[model samples]
Target: MALKILSGCINCDMCEPECPNQAISMGEKIYEINPDLCTECVGFYDKPTCISVCPIDVIITDPAHIESKESLLEKFKHLVNTDRI
Candidate 1:
């Protein structure tokens, strides 16, 4: 599943660089995660790198785009395979 930044975000630049999928980006008000690119670090790390680095704990899973581990893994695999072609 994709993670969403809450309203309390401090506009900190910490989370974006930590994303293995390179999914986080600066939004108009705060940082945003690209659901199409966000794999929740399923293939790269044990935990979500953004969540682990977020100092204020404002990151949470997107309920609207909820997904399973298997789906995320599949997404990651697709991304990896796509990068080759």
Candidate 2:
């Protein structure tokens, strides 16, 4: 699943740069993760970098956009190369 930054975020700016897919961005009030670009770090690392670096641990799996690990890897490949199958 994609990760969501909860409202508990303290805007510490620790999670944004940690995303391998560049999915995290500064929102009006907190950091936001783009579901389209998020892969839970499946293809890039053993765990989500954003979650690891978050000072407050506000990141949570997005139940609304649940996806399998295999699918997340596929998405990561697609993101890096659209021509890839």
Candidate 3:
């Protein structure tokens, strides 16, 4: 599943650069994760790097964008093939 930043995010800027897919970016108030680009690091790492580096546990799976590991891997492959990574 894709990840989303919760309301309590500190905007620490720790996640944006850590995302291998460049799925994270600064939003109007805090950082936001692009669901279309987020794969929870399935193809890049065992765990999401954003979550790993987050000082606060504000990042969580997006229930609205639920997906399985296979789907995430497919998305990762698509991103790579399209040069969107």
Most lDDT-accurate candidate: 3
**Model 3, range 1-61, lDDT digits (tens) per residue?**
9999998999998999999999999999999999999999998899999999999999999
User: Could you give candidate 2's per-residue lDDT for residues 1-85 as a string of tens digits?
Assistant: 9999999999998888889889999998888999999999988899999989988788999999999998999999899896354
- For each candidate, give its TM-score against the true structure: 0.95, 0.93, 0.96
Which residue pairs come into collision in candidate 2? none
Residue 5, candidate 2: alpha-carbon lDDT: 93
Of the candidates shown, which would achieve the greatest TM-score relative to the real structure? 3
Please tell me which model should have the higher lDDT, number 1 or number 3. Answer: 3
RMSD of each: 0.8, 2.1, 1.5
Segments of candidate 2 deviating more than 4 angstroms: 83-85
Query: Candidate 1: which stretches are off by over 4 Å?
Result: none
Per-residue lDDT tens digits of candidate 1, residues 3-70?
Answer: 99998999889999999888999998999999999999999999998999999999999998999999
Top-down TM-score ranking: 3, 1, 2
Question: How much lDDT does each candidate structure score?
Answer: 0.93, 0.91, 0.96
Instruction: Indicate whether candidate 1 or candidate 2 has the larger TM-score.
Output: 1
